[model samples]
Target: MDKDASGPKVVVGVDGSESSYAALRWAVRYAGLVGGTVDAVSVWELPGRYGWSAPAVDMDVDEEEARRRMRQELTDVLGTDAAESVRTHVVHGNPADVLLRAAEGAEVLVVGSRGRGGFARVLLGSVGQHVAQHAGCPVVIVRSGPS
Candidate 1:
């Protein structure tokens, strides 16, 4: 749906990875062309299994810090003018789930082929694949290669 009089809103997932950075850049350019705002989302999740140690307190604080850094990084890459057109969001949960939820009201969802995952795939990352398959809106899987 359109968030403004200009055009439909676009959502892009960011995890501070090189591929995600590329996707952010592409999303900014696309938004500029289509006259829409970009919602940059950064999702953080606690490690499922930690060593035989006590659960850490104040974890939410860490997540918030990470989110703030991510938003600043996106702003830095997109620059002040283009970044002003972007709305940053930081959520704590599964990356794929957060992105899919964000995609619910977006005209298009953009994500990189890979993030910090250590999967051995030669192509798309697991999170990107999941979003592409389940996102309600059109999904753009930005790769690290030439456009």
Candidate 2:
């Protein structure tokens, strides 16, 4: 059992992907091992352009949807009891930027090898690569196991 409610913080980025689910599970187990709390973060932003031009976007709607999805993903991946133990955050910004900022002073930042986007041929996704290079704390990039 975790003795310290105020122990080290483990920050994890979840994007509802298989690799991300794997990362989430890993973060929970690691947090348990170290008696730390988990901070599960998800980020969403309107696309820069909609093919030719920018489309009208509703910030309120987008943020709310992001928050809802994050919560559902947490429950789907970690279940109710386990998910409740981790603090959840839904931010509006670039994935890498948000995750790095969230990881500030954290024990470690955990992310999947790839998120929703990117070519499978590539080893690491853009956000994972960026955070691995720029995060102030240690970063762990987990790849999903065989399905």
Name the top TM-score candidate.
2
lDDT of 2 by residue, 24-133 (tens): 99999999999999988887777652342676565555677777778878888889999889888887778888898889878999999998885877779999999999
Q: What C-alpha root-mean-square deviation, in Å, does candidate 1 show against the real structure?
A: 3.8
- What overall lDDT, based on C-alpha atoms, would model 1 receive against the true structure? 0.80
Q: What value of lDDT does candidate 2 attain over all alpha carbons?
A: 0.86
What digit string (tens of lDDT, one per residue) describes model 1 on residues 62-101?
7667766876797788877777777888887788888988
TM agreement with the true structure for every prediction: 0.82, 0.86
Give residue 109's error in model 2 in angstroms: 0.1
Candidate number of the best lDDT? 2
**Any runs in candidate 2 off by more than 4 Å, and if so which?**
1-5, 49-62
